[model samples]
Each structure stands twice: as structure tokens, then as C-alpha cells.
Target: MEPNNEQAQGLYRLCYRLTNVIYPGWQYRPIQLVRIDERTGNVYVLAGESDFEIKPTGGYEP
Candidate 1:
């Protein structure tokens, strides 16, 4: 799917503010470019060794 700049930026802001563990460099941890599922509106982010799946409704699914 084509990457959405606005979507990723918004998600990054939300995640960083909500978790404080996802940010620029995460202050030391690794931060990778996020991937989004255009079909399901699911966002995937990898930080260090952690993986997150953010739902469209601003929810996290396990």
C-alpha cells in the first residue's frame, strides 16, 4: 500500500504522547518507519524490539 505521510505523523504523535516510548530515537531506543494497512486502517510500528498494531478506532489490538 502507498504510505500516508499525514497518517504516520499523526499516529507517531499520538503514540509518543500516549506512551512516551515512541518518539524521535525514543531517546535511545530504535524507531522505524511505520506501515499501514490501507485496507483495514491498521497501523504497524516497530520500536526497538516492540511491535504495535494500532487500530482505526484509536485502539490497540493484541
Candidate 2:
């Protein structure tokens, strides 16, 4: 797999774990990579209705 894809999957796992904590009673659907902005090194993910933007600096922009 591509390095970016691996990174995205790792981030996706983090996002999923976070959602489970925030919403314990919810059922999970698949997480998806909505987009990747290489110039800014930003990864966008969709987890159910929640969205996340992961920056290269190591933080989430909800």
C-alpha cells in the first residue's frame, strides 16, 4: 500500500476509536478518505456523519 494510504488508515482508526468514546451507543459504518491535499499535507476523513481533517503537524480539525 502507499505510504499516504497507510497513514490515512492509521488516522482513520484513531478517528473511529474517538467516535466510539464520544458515541458509545452508535453502530459504526465504514470510514472513508474524502480527500487529500498534498500541498498542505491534510487528510480529510468521513466517519458516519462526523468529519475530520488531520493535519501534518499532528492534530485534528473537526
Candidate 3:
């Protein structure tokens, strides 16, 4: 499924923040949007050279 503008923006923001927190100082190259949980409204972004599933907690809940 294609993400809308807002969703895409939100996901990008989330990805940026997650990258800093979860993989600090690492050169992260986002590969693709792997998945977006409908229940949780959580976006899964696959970053190159890492196997970390960064889930943003707090403020966002769905």
C-alpha cells in the first residue's frame, strides 16, 4: 500500500528520530518502508548495515 503525504512525512520524521536514538553515529541509509502496522500505526523502516527494529514509544499510540 502506498502511504499518503502525511503518513510519509510522519514516517520520515519517525525514521530520523529512531536512527539517532537506536543507531547513534552510524551511517544509516534507509532502504525502504518494510511495513506499517495498522493496529499500532507504527512504521517499520529498513536501514542499511543494521538489523535494528526501532519502535518509537510515547506520544504516539493507536
Candidate 4:
């Protein structure tokens, strides 16, 4: 199935962030962004077999 433009853009942006902005110093650590179910708003970040869970660090849930 082909993803829409919005989804594509989101995926690319997420990838860029993960590679550059998020972990600029960690080149050895590979990151994978998985958009589990956009229809159900299920997105995840996996760094190995575990999902990189981001806990609330005193910020908005937006």
C-alpha cells in the first residue's frame, strides 16, 4: 500500500530527526522509526528489539 503525502513527509521528518537532531553523537547506534498503525495513531521507535519508550519529561503530550 502506498502512503499519502502527509504520511510520507512525517516519516521522512521523523527519520531525519532520529538520525540527526535526536542523536547526533551516537553514530554507532542505529535507530528505526516504525509507523505501526497511522489509522489508529500507533507509532513507535525501535532501537534493537525494544521499543524506545519516551517517558514524560515534564513537557506537553502534543
lDDT score, candidate 4, position 17: 53
lDDT of 4 by residue, 1-60 (tens): 344455555555545555664566533334655544445443455744445422222111
TM-score per model over all chains: 0.51, 0.51, 0.39, 0.41
Per-model C-alpha RMSD = 5.4, 4.6, 6.3, 6.9
Candidate 4 or 1, higher lDDT: 1
Model 3 spans with C-alpha error above 4 angstroms = 21-33, 37-62
Q: Which sections of candidate 1 miss by over 4 Å?
A: 1-10, 13-28
Clashes of each: 0, 0, 0, 0
* Deviation from truth (RMSD, Å), model 3: 6.3
**Local distance difference test, each candidate:** 0.62, 0.64, 0.53, 0.45
Candidate 3 steric clashes: 0
Better of 3 and 4 by lDDT: 3
Q: Clashing residue pairs in candidate 4, if any? A: none
Q: RMSD in angstroms, candidate 1?
A: 5.4
Per-residue CA lDDT of candidate 2, range 1-62, in tens?
A: 12265556657666667556566665665566566776777777776677878766545666
Compute the lDDT for candidate 4.
Answer: 0.45
Cα RMSD for predicted model 4: 6.9
Clashing residue pairs in candidate 3 are none
Worst 10 residues of 1 by lDDT: 21-30
